[model samples]
Target: MNTTTLLFEAPGPRGRRRCRLFEIISWAVLAGIAYLVIQTLDKRGAFDAAAWQPLGQLGVWRQLGVGLLNNVRAAVVGMLLSMFFGCFLGWGLLSGHKIVRYPCRAFTDLFNGIPVLLLLFFTSLALPAWGLPLTDFWFLVIALSLYSTAVIADLVRAGVQALPRGESEAAAALGFSGLQSMWLILLPQALRMMSPALVSQMVIVFKGTTLAFVLGGYFDLLRAATVLGAYYSRSLLQAQGIAAVAFMLINIALSQTAAAIDRRERRRYGVPPIGTGSRSPGMPE
Candidate 1:
């Protein structure tokens, strides 16, 4: 009997060629679609100087700033409030007492199940009858916070669940109280794991500020664009262009902020560098 050893090889030149070909085809299709869109817009005069004049006007920028300021204020307030509520609710849910956990779970589920627009409408309209003294902006902020909090609560709960049981057992072995174990040992690690989800929720809350239009205020980017379009004789394209630019700017800002926070978390926790086998910079040995 003769024994022969066969060396296994990773995907080679042929595999690489197929991947390159696939990428080229994907890019070609994308470029073709973009060209077709441009041609269609050009035929419709969408790229004309007159068509884009509204965007060039200085008043448009001022209007955009005012609208953006209001929305930013609302988003910031809502995000802060939502984070507070979420942390509390999450803590309650993981308190190890059914009475505390069940109610929190119920509330989170109830709020998450509701449509954001309906929640804003009810807050702005129904709450006023009960003498809530809530303005449209405030009402919208409250609604957004409540909705976003529910989502954040779930993120917190998942983070807590992902924590190792040994940590809690060790804390118990050390005679640490339950609250102490939670506050010092569990929550910090959980918060680090939860940061990405919180940032995503923040982006959603920021975008959700656009629903303020339903509350009868011209305080959001969408309403501002609509007003500008009305002034320009109902040019839907102009309105859409304004809104697109505004939302793009907002999303870019949020993405940058999230990236910064993620970097900070990695540095703080000394987590291993992504895709590297080495231990992260701040992690314990």
Candidate 2:
């Protein structure tokens, strides 16, 4: 190894030993904190197995099942709608006419910049005043879709923009209209390139469904947990841990699936390897 110092020298034996010691210390501290938290929770009766008994009851499971179904329904609908509208808006963003491009750009920026929770709140409260008469489910789905549409729009736009100029030039030479070129050539390629980003965004939309609990009318996973907790004395802590674990497991599974798809796409496309920090255009890691 080159020991020549540029910013700092590579670790010598003593430094490496110190690094290992620091790692051990960090893990020890983390374990201690975790132990303390568990002890505290136990003292508060959070570990009482009876508190979790409600989860095994048929009625309780039925309610939670319904909530899960509702959550999945909203997420699926929102993801589909977002992708549809986002594709069109993305096309508009790349349009030659300022009339199409500017409006799309402005709308995308406005919605994308707003917090999803605020959008849900605004959609839940304001639409009734505007005489839309949407139910809580529709309101939440619309809000989630709108925010996701903006994000996916930007992702699409960036993907298209990143394509090789030769593709467009060849399409023009072949006498393809701009729309034809985009639909038949560019859009397909962009979709493949941005698949990982789109999948990740879908996960975000799925997680956002939990926000529906705040609206009171939507009985999502979080609300179901709240109901379960209420049925048992001082079981809120138990319910919270259960719900957190459930969400964590679901998210982990989704991320793993996405990673698998990403690997498959990379292999199919024969794309060269990239560093960890590199990601799809206009998408955050």
**Best-fitting candidate, measured by lDDT?**
2
TM-score of each: 0.76, 0.88
Write the residue-wise lDDT of candidate 2 on 73-129 in tens digits.
Answer: 999999999999999999999999999999999999999999999999899889999
Query: Could you tell me the lDDT of residue 39 within candidate 1?
Result: 97
Q: Which 10-residue window in model 2 sums to the lowest lDDT?
A: 272-281
Find the candidate with the highest TM-score and give its number: 2
Instruction: Give candidate 1 regions above 4 Å deviation.
Output: 1-36, 164-177, 180-185, 234-236, 267-285
Q: Clashes in model 1: which pairs?
A: 270-280, 270-282, 270-283, 271-280, 272-280
Model 2 segments more than 4 A misplaced: 1-15, 272-285
Cα lDDT of candidate 1 equals 0.80
- Residue 160 CA displacement from its true place in model 2, Å: 1.2
